[model samples]
Target: MGLAERRKVMGYSQERFAAVVGVDRTTVGRWDRGETTPEAIHRPKMAEALQLGLAELDALLTPPPADFPECTASPPCDRHGSEGIDDMIRREFLRIMVVAGSLTTLAPDDADAIAEAVDRGSAEDFRLMNGHLWQVYQLARSKSSVNTVVKDQLGALNEALKESSRAGGLYEVAGDLFQLSGELSFDGNRYTDAAASYALAAEASSHARAYDLWACALVRHAYVDVYERRYTEAAETLDVARRVAKRGNSALSTRYWVASVQAEVYAGLQDLGACEKALGEAQRVADLATPVHPGGWLRFDGSRLAEERGARYVQLGRLDLAEETLRRALETKTLSRGQSFRRRGAVLVDLAAVGAKRHDAEQVVTYGGEALRLAKKTGSGYIARRLQALQGDLRTCRRNRRVVELNAEINAL
Candidate 1:
């Protein structure tokens, strides 16, 4: 049965179903008409609203022709294997929307519609949309689909930006969107794009006077400069970010977080004393207890000190120190969660990079393999870049089939 039929069977009017699903009535109409499908992620909630078991609801929702990839291809199983296929297809479909908008310029009306959708969208919507875009961005880079994918989303992104500015004003929303945009650009290796996005993010945060958000953007922007080997520019950017952070919020730990990042910028500039001093300052700020983090994404509650220290040592080519600090950091796994997979994986990649510099292929393979796994799981560009930098070391291990696989994976990423 179609959605409308199923809802009627459950004694739910279209209006009731729409209300239960937290969507508009028109959205329900679209679902009933099969013009659009409910997101897989929302299936469980939909099932609950229909008073059906999650599995049973899914079975009922499944289109006869769709069959879901696994049910048709795989051997029958006790559980519904179609769920996995459904998720994969859903993920790819969302990714395609972002890519299509980015590669082929969206129609003016379509662009406007996307803008409206974003402006009125919840954080959950942004997460679902951007998460898929990020995955595609990862695959596109590895598969050399860069031109087609990255270019296609630009028009929609521009439209989204205009809408974000109009709707977000000078507050958290604006800062959040700016940071997301900056990170996306940075992931694509478009440093200039990253810098521009970060600049606007910082400005918006400043208008809201949110110290942490502003400082985080500055730090993100500094990363681009660091990547370009422009140490002076990176240091200057961090310095400015630091000053703003210090003045804006004494209650906030953003200054300290920026201080930690700045330490690396100092290391990049070969300023050992300044780097150490900044580290000390970061520790001092981190010592304070806070009930809540100001910004969800910008939370630098000072818990990542070990990783920060390891990163600094890595920058200085002090492999021994880097390994020790990174190992210690890994020991404190409490700070590392699913969301922090990308950050922890980055540290692992750096450690592997250090092992590579020392011609320790065993160490490289051990750490690099794990890091590569994490990179694939998280789609982290930072980790991928670090692995890329270890190419020279991989060459030294040409005879090892494991290293061959590692190189292929890193190259693919």
Candidate 2:
């Protein structure tokens, strides 16, 4: 049996098996595909996990001979001298999306990549994979869980950047990848790391002249400031993002997403009129026609705007409005559930905050308890952070047993 088949027989899924070896699951995938080998450190554990002797494991790692090369020659060509990526390149790039991270080290391939231009086809390959990684990142419970694979993919793209004869497409890929790195950092509350990654993403997208991507990167950078309660600083950043998005595709929701975030910062600064005005601009997204928001890199389809609006109201101390709006948002089917629980959990936390404002112990326990469960279920640091912020509010009802238990749980996270 081959390595993949042997792994299945041992009842270890790729994720489980990778965890055993202390590596990203994609590394196990590359090993199964014969595109790479297990490092010395991983082999012994691989053998043990796969129920193989060291000798047998070594044999298993040698994949059966194939009719084609494991990886294609770069600056690709067919026998007829037609230029483009082959089926192998397409497949390889699918796996490559999760492989990259920060562009800290220059790979050895830089010299070779700079020798010939990477075509639009190759750039598209990276784009497709980059989009997939965003989907994976959104669905992942612990956002940090994606950190390793993203770093590895960035390394791969670092070489791709060198190989590019046409720089535009590759630069866009760089923007996309760096934003993902920023997202992982942001999700983990590593604001310093997030700032650095977002700055790189902004630079790359600006180089590609991709207004939406560039604007989004700036918006994300501003979020770090918002989290730190540096409302004025965040507003300055958003002002720039707003102008950039104006130059973006009119068909996109980029401007509206920027407006949505701007509303948050305005609420933070206690500027009710400005906050409401920004929110009205955000509401305009529901009117756009055709060329819908791309689910991967730009998922702001206005689906979560209601929840966002409600949360902003909470920030503005509009308790009555916040409670009503948040409850309505929860009733709607738009809030993602199942493994997609981040937004929903935030809504619950908001409702709990409203209850805490009223010193309503039952309401606090009801909403806070559900939010806590979602945080634990998803291993989501974002939800945990929101719940942590609510800890002070929960103290008003501390005499209640459920509130006390909830406080302890949030503290544990």
Candidate 3:
């Protein structure tokens, strides 16, 4: 058992544990995520709370070897037993092999070495690489640049699906891969392809009995409708997502992320009360004691809640709320490393839109110019798309020379 498991054994919520250790709640989250270590002074208190001696606490803190999946560092252990672990490794290894290309093509000795390593639990190799690819996708300047890797992963997953049984854990991996593929399609503005990918993801997640993954896929599918301006259809789809998420593991922020997107759908439908309620549900993610997301599939964590809420406010034509909330989101971005180019870019565009709607050319040029630079720098079609959508609002400030110039630059993009 690790610190998270031990803390639960000791009946300490993450908040209580952090308070006992004299640290912020998020600091505890970082520790649970293995992103940071406790200071020496904090270790003793941590050990005491976890009911472990200092040396034993150190052992718990030490990561499992890169080869083994002793346990994932976050979300705690939901599956138990050696049989479950073995089945998971067996199928996951199939995926790993496919990612490495044809196994038979490998030198005989190299192939033999991999077979031996699998017995010693080398599935972590594939697991970590999958997680790394997600980080790469999130941080890459050009979102579409991750397509080749995603396509390869999809090929592997489809192959695995051919022989794998339901509930064998490969389905969960399939769910993850399908979501990544959908994201790539969405970034390329292929809404139909994205929707199809999400549907497959949902099907895989359902077969796996992974409620969180299943719910998130539905949310993404609904977003395709939202993007096409089908607010009624999107709202209907998101309502189903919310129900599925209620069946999800509450430890993860799956429901909250669904609620977050639902807020956007409601905003599009011009239901201010429903939008506010959904945002409130999303905010409840912060009240959870453990890390909100696994950083792999469900990355809600409430880190971008401010920005999303602000954006929804913009959609609802509440300029004052949008401006104040988005400004707070900007300030909040500095505190968390989880902020991405897409996230911040979306926020800047909303702020710029707020300015346009209010007929404030200074706000328009100031925020819009910065957003334009991000669009160019990251080559993010999402940012450029947001900018394109703001053109009609820009007419309100057409008299401003800087606005005219910025419009020209955006047009070029």
Candidate 4:
């Protein structure tokens, strides 16, 4: 029997079952509809409420395939023992990775060898390869091209984790891979999946005693809240990230990244004084001569500070400041070279937003058009989303033919 049938057999209504499980009625409804599974925390309560053992609960919850038999004999045979079950689970994980297009290139032997190397405490090669994958992911014009390799790396890390003898180094590598997974999800606008990946990254980093990696994951997770307009939640998450960053290496500039993101959260909250203070803290990273990012995962080196500051100013409705900062960002060598279309597109969109605020239709058309083109060329959901925001601003100047055309073009993207 499924969850709904089990609940009915127990003589408990959906509302009462939800109360017993300490969740909303809609959550119970979602489970019944197969929309989402119970989170880890809620599963025990659900089992208790149904008066069922964990195994029995799992069996009921899982729908059997058409070819699978329902045992008619008493005391079902335990054909797949613990070892078999574990092997099956791993196989299923690999199958899902294949279906998701995350493990296309690497052979099973290659994955096994990498995992074995990590388990034997020789993780340098694995780490270096993962770092190269991250660099490729960042520099590639089509971000999705790197997903298969990253996913393959994650699969190898998971295999290594099954052996606990050398877990410390494996955890560290796993943390980095999780962060890369989060970045891939975020770039595709899968915010919920990104948040889950970041949460796992933080947990793995904590187990490895890698404070900077943990804090970086927290910062990335906070972005989900920030983008969703959960300002208070984002601020609270960033505050924890800041405290964690304090315990990380002073040479790494992790704290500076925390400060930079804090500025964005502050701008979202409209706290101008706090925003400026955080921005000032982020600026200190520019003074550090040595490279701050070792793995290419935490790539915030203050090169994009001008554009970031402009974005914060735009968030705060300071058009005069935003226009100047973004224009300066456009002139910066990094942006001027056009190597990073995502960065340039963001700056252009912000500048167009400023122009829309100032009712300068010509400026809006010029910047917005270029941003739209970059969005198409790069297939960047980040840039497309920013243009959607610009679309709202252009509506105010809809009377202008240029503004109307630009708005339509953005909508097409």
Write down the lDDT of every candidate, Cα atoms only: 0.66, 0.78, 0.75, 0.78
Output the lDDT of residue 309, model 4: 93
Cα deviation in Å at residue 374, candidate 4?
A: 0.5
Candidate 4 lDDT tens digits, 1-413: 78998899998898999889876586688678864556445779888988988888878777775453566766774455433432343343344333322332322433323345435554564588678888798888878776655654555455444433435466667678778877877878778778877887787677666899999999999999987789899999999999999999889889999999999999988999999999999999988878877856688888888899999999999988898889999998888899899999999999989988888998999999899989998999889888886777887688999889888887787
How far out, in Å, is residue 272 in model 3? 1.2
- Candidate 3 RMSD to the real structure: 16.3
Q: Rank the candidates by lDDT, best first.
A: 2, 4, 3, 1
What's the true lDDT of residue 158 in model 4?
54
Worst 10 residues of 1 by lDDT: 147-156
lDDT, candidate 4, at 131: 81
Write one digit per residue (lDDT tens) for candidate 1, span 1-413.
Answer: 66788789888888888888876576677678764566555677788877778778767766775343444534665244445432332233334334333422433433322334445564345444445555544344232333223232332234344334333321344455556656665765667767776776676566556677788888888888887778898888988988887776677677787788878788887788899999999888756668425544456777778788888887777889999989888767563554466566777777777777787778888989988887776566676777786676677677778788889888888
Model 3 residue 313 CA deviation in Å: 1.8
lDDT (tens digit, per residue) of candidate 3 on 237-324: 8888889989988888999888899889999989999998988999999999777788866888887788888899899999998999
- Model 2 lDDT, full chain set: 0.78
Candidate 2 off by > 4 Å? 1-117, 336-339
Clashing pairs in 4: none
Clashing pairs in 3: none
Model 1, position 61, has a per-residue lDDT of: 61
